[model samples]
Target: MGNQPETHPNPTIDPKSGFNSETRTFQSLRPKTPLPPLSQPLSVTDYTLSLIPSTSLSATAMIDSDTDTHLSYSVFIRQIKSLSSSLKSLFPSLSKGHVALIISPSSLHVPVLYFSLLSLGVVVAPANPLSTHSELTHHVQLTKPVIAFATSSTSTHIPNLKFGTVLIDSPQFISMLNNFNNSEPPRVEVAQSDVAAILFSSGTTGRVKGVELTHRNFIALTGGFYYTNLMLGNLDEKESNKVSLFTPPLFHVFGFFMMVWTIAFGETLVLMKRFDFEGMLKLVEKYRIDSIPVSPPLVVLLAKSELVNKYDVSSLKIVGCGGAPLGKEVGESFAARFPNVIIEQVT
Candidate 1:
């Protein structure tokens, strides 16, 4: 949290402005402002927006592609500010507890959309794009979301999901972005125990059951390990970190929290929709990537992929693995392939 300003002012600040008779001039002063925590009733989405006027710190979400990028840290937060401008008006009659589902490929849109839902004191259920039609429909039906924002990447799959999926990358979405305002949305009061996210353990443990990770759980993960920079140490050259090549799916908890939130730390995440041995290696070498958070299965491919030896991956410092166990032999193979890359497990 080095630059993550621990203190913020109040959200509702009313300054008194009146003519000072003694001084014979107009005077005004504002009291201590609301410093709401990102997960608080106001949500970090709004907190992120408040920082935009200060400087341009980026929180980029790359849904793949080198140029098709949106929002760095500050910019990302600002974009969130823009998106939240029409919250209640967008869904006037819905309860504050009802969620707004976001299924987009634009990395910029994901955090703001999700956090905006959370800020309203609603629960979030992220459906994986790779999930089958039945799987996607099951989660949708199970949760019964009120509003949804989805990308065309898998539009055909949820053709009849009984929800309005705001096409964020389409002409309509562009118009929405262009016409969006910066006014804050109606904030809701949330408790620490409120469910911030619902994560499912990978099928390794059989059918996935939604693991209700509350706001407290999210705070601990970020405040405890991730924000401490356990994975990005290798990314640092002298004093700053390097851009990371992200090949994991955004829906996976490993990618969503671990990689997605890494943006606020002033790091770049280069996303690849899905892992391709050759393609991933090319990007790593191309970007001179500093860090990567991946799975064990993919690690094996990264270890054995001809691209490892075919190109330069010397820039890589650490490989963070989650969602499964990596065998000693496989770990050794990965170590042998990239001696500079340290492997860490979160199982």
Candidate 2:
């Protein structure tokens, strides 16, 4: 007889856990997200810019909750382009592969600067604005940044660098944002593998370490959130009007990545310079905020704080908790309180 066809039974998978018994692993149930070609020369800035809807250009991109200032998407993109040109002209020494340290509180300007720097292929190394002199020095040493960006209050902590420091709150920096006469800055060819940002660890175990993230790393991260939301039917027409309040520090991974995702999805982001329980509640009511990315502590506060009752937070639809594990009790308490709201825990 000819060779008999091999016979095998299909592997059993747990529907609830998505576990493959034969493979001894948990399989992903979500559809795979498509990323750009690895060989393509694309920066995270370009990738994110491409995803923004042209129709939303005139929409509000960000709002400073502290100052009640609003920045439109049209103005935001213009500033990025203008600032990119100004930076190149003012500091001819700055170029691709150079690192720039950014130490400032969250504001409208920080996001614009981030996109501009990434487009130039400059590695953004943002540290806490409240970092001690010694800590700042350690970071400077690690990244060897050519220039530093700081606010007047935090610039003193920055050490001397190759190009000195530019205060983000200074008039000169503001002028840079308005330099419309300058032609568009020459684009740099950035590889997916090129180091884009040097983020630091939380320093829980030991000294804080700089973590290098590449352009592709951020592209994939943003793409995952974008495509997943699309697949889950979460990007409906109403989703475009969703407003998000970010209470986390911009330097942290949670806030940093979410900022990127928020821009790519063209959502209005409200930034709080500092976190205050009552202040956060008030902003939610004022802005009609429907989404917030938070930590466990904030989750607990939302679940237990009576201050939440004082404000009209009925608009809140999603609360994303990260940075640590959310206790079952805490999760249940939050769910019980806001039965209609979704509490998404991100590792």
Candidate 3:
């Protein structure tokens, strides 16, 4: 033989359960996913933007399920660039390492602003738009954001900050998105370890605290989802045609990360400004939503609600449930009702 390859013994596994007794844990059988070098300078926005297929640029990127408004990938990218440039010009003091608070409901503008802020290396701190003045103040104290973005209705709740507040609903904000300067935002070298966002806890158990998430954290998360889908043979030539509806609030960690994940794969995301059980079903039927991220409560509702039969939900392929413990009975009922749809529980 010209050369012989070295071989190693297979890992020991229990014959009955396939458990690794030596390590006292079961090893994942999935193939390892390749990640970029840790020392490399990268932002979650850049990583996600790189994953978008060139062909998907013309496809729908987001839809306002309430108003039926549509946003294309091409326009969304352009808006991100434009908004980034405009923010730099408007608030020269806003720079990398600075935090910006975002208090807004689910809207097409939120994602564009999020990507823009991240590209510029600004730390995004998004809070519940429905928060009271005292709650907003607590958030402001925690993050110490220099600038804030809010809507006309929610702006009153936010305390003044260094850069004041930019109302997303104003005509002025729209003009920023339509920046005609043609000059791109100056390139920002964001380290993967830099803080990306500060999201708040639910405050159910105690006082809500700000949770810091780094750029590398999100890059890894989005990457894992991207590769897992590929491994499952979910990403095909028609991947852009897949639609996902988000029932969670954008300010929550579940919704925020999933939003980024959906965009990274160039899938159309449907957002509802306000969650209505019947409205969610209507959107599912209208857009042919393939998947949805749901909480335990939503899962129970889906399993037992009579309204589910009122619409055509045959297109739903997956229901990702997380954020809390799902009762075994609830999971069984949901599985039995939606036999074709897979219930993916995340612990």
Ranked by lDDT, the better of candidates 1 and 2 is 2
Q: How much lDDT does candidate 3 score? A: 0.90
Predicted candidate 2 versus true structure: per-residue lDDT over 147-238, tens digit per residue: 99999999998877899999999999999998888899888899999999999998889998999999999999999888877766776744
Q: Put down candidate 3 lDDT per residue, 1-347, tens digits, no spaces.
A: 11222222455765444467777886554455667887999999999999987778899999998789999999999999999999988998788989999999999999999999999999999999999989998998899999999999999978778999999999999999978575988899999999999999999989889999999999988888888777677778665478999999888999999999999889899999999899999999999999999999999999999999999999999999978888999999999999999989864
lDDT, model 2: 0.90
Which residue runs of candidate 2 sit more than 4 Å off their true CA positions?
A: 1-29, 238-240
Model 1 regions lying over 4 Å from their true place? 1-63, 66-70, 104-106, 157-163, 178-180, 201-208, 230-238
Q: Candidate 3 — which residues are off by over 4 angstroms?
A: 1-29
Q: What TM-score do all the candidates reach, one by one? A: 0.75, 0.93, 0.92
Sort all candidates by TM-score, best to worst. Answer: 2, 3, 1
Query: Which pairs of residues collide in candidate 2?
Result: none
What is the lDDT for 283 in model 2? 95
Q: What is the lDDT of residue 332 in candidate 2?
A: 98
**Candidate 3 C-alpha error for residue 174, in Å:** 0.8
